[model samples]
Target: MKKINLIIATTLFSITFSIGAFAQTETKIGALIGYGTEIENIGIGANAEFPIMEKLTISPSFIYYLPKDESGIKINWFEVNANANYYFLDEENIDVYGIAGLNYSSIKVKYENSFGLGGDFSSSDGRIGLNLGAGANFNIGSSITPFAELKYVIIDGGQLVVAAGVKFNL
Candidate 1:
């Protein structure tokens, strides 16, 4: 009876400790900058990541492209995206991950002819699209992790996005 009691106590302790060690949730916020091919513009973005499972993370992000103007027409664009990332190689100091997401993009255009005979014109449009990307995170002992990613955005016209950012784990 004494031996059985000791074995059960030991097993319970081991299980409790193991669960405590691996059940931590990770949350991170980051600021990003990107360049896109279709628009030929620079974009600024921010994102937050939360762990859903041991190998999966969900990130919500927002990005805005700098306004561009040509021949009296000005265009502004922005996007909101939610991404699911799967980490295939999670190590002590590095993580390699693949991401897929859905994005909603909005564009506003304003036009005014250079001649005095023209009036103001404005239009807005929204598009729902998909994004696929791969990234690597390098942990440098601090709470900050630096990452770089390249993603393709499939919509009316395909766009390639390249970005880099630092994430703060909280």
Candidate 2:
């Protein structure tokens, strides 16, 4: 729908802006395992470090979460995020950075909730939200690097999250 299109457009704009303003390094792709209150998920992301300036990078990641409920029912959701990373400490092969950007998320309810008269209600929607986080990366001996990140969404009640992943330099 319109909202989905808007999310795609905005993401493209940001990636284009970053590429224009920063010289890009080689491309690297990785996967992640994330844990959050009320949810557990897995993610895959790509990293693009800026050329000439190694202190900055851009990361685009996608995630899918399993359903959970008090009554042992499942509720699924998915999200995609693009973050701008600024490294405060850039060592030989290690870097710790701060992140900020946009996240587009969609929630789907697979099971219906029973009403007072045993009726069921279910719904699904997509939301474009803000993302902010920080992470540290350590060079694992060679071209491989391991990283840990923590991010939170700017939702009304807030969504706290943590992730661990590895990146391979291309």
Candidate 3:
């Protein structure tokens, strides 16, 4: 495991930076559709960005996964995230950034037996974890920017989330 991590670190350090997009620090509001790899379910989310300094921003978002039920069991999941975005490139119409933040994930499960011979159960658990990811924004126009992100939530069981959406400048 340590060797793999070192290899990854070395690879990242060896890559040369490329010029990409025009840098902007405007505030934006947006909505997203995301997929959780571990849950195998689709989710909807909303997020807003506030620039705190040049080339850096704080983005807060929330996502709610559509419930999934099988074999008399139902599961629901959601997450709230706060991340800092640091833009690393500035050349063309696309800006790439790295993100690191905190994640709060909640999962609820319920089981019910329709027959007269069994007991029903329900429980909910919430976890706090770390988030590491990368994202990009397409500066196609002035009023709106389209973006996509891939992030991994590090909790009891890590999950990768892929999301894409548009940000409305406000």
Q: Which model scores highest in TM-score? A: 3
lDDT tens per residue, model 1, 87-167: 999888889999899877788899986687868899987778999999889989998999888888889997888989999
In angstroms, give how far residue 44 of model 2 lies from its true place.
6.8
Candidate 3 local lDDT, 50-135, one digit each (tens): 77778888787889899999898999988878789999986589999999998878888999989967799999888889999999
The collision pairs in model 2 are 67-75
For model 1, give the 10-residue run with minimal summed lDDT: 1-10
lDDT of 3 at 110: 99
RMSD of each: 14.9, 4.0, 11.1
List where candidate 3 sits over 4 angstroms from the true fold: 1-25
Candidate ordering by lDDT (highest first): 3, 1, 2
Candidate 2 per-residue lDDT, tens place, 34-114, comes to 775535554444444433356666777777675556473557676778777888987877778998988777776665555
lDDT for model 2 comes to 0.70
TM-score of each: 0.83, 0.74, 0.84
How many clashes show up per model? 0, 1, 4
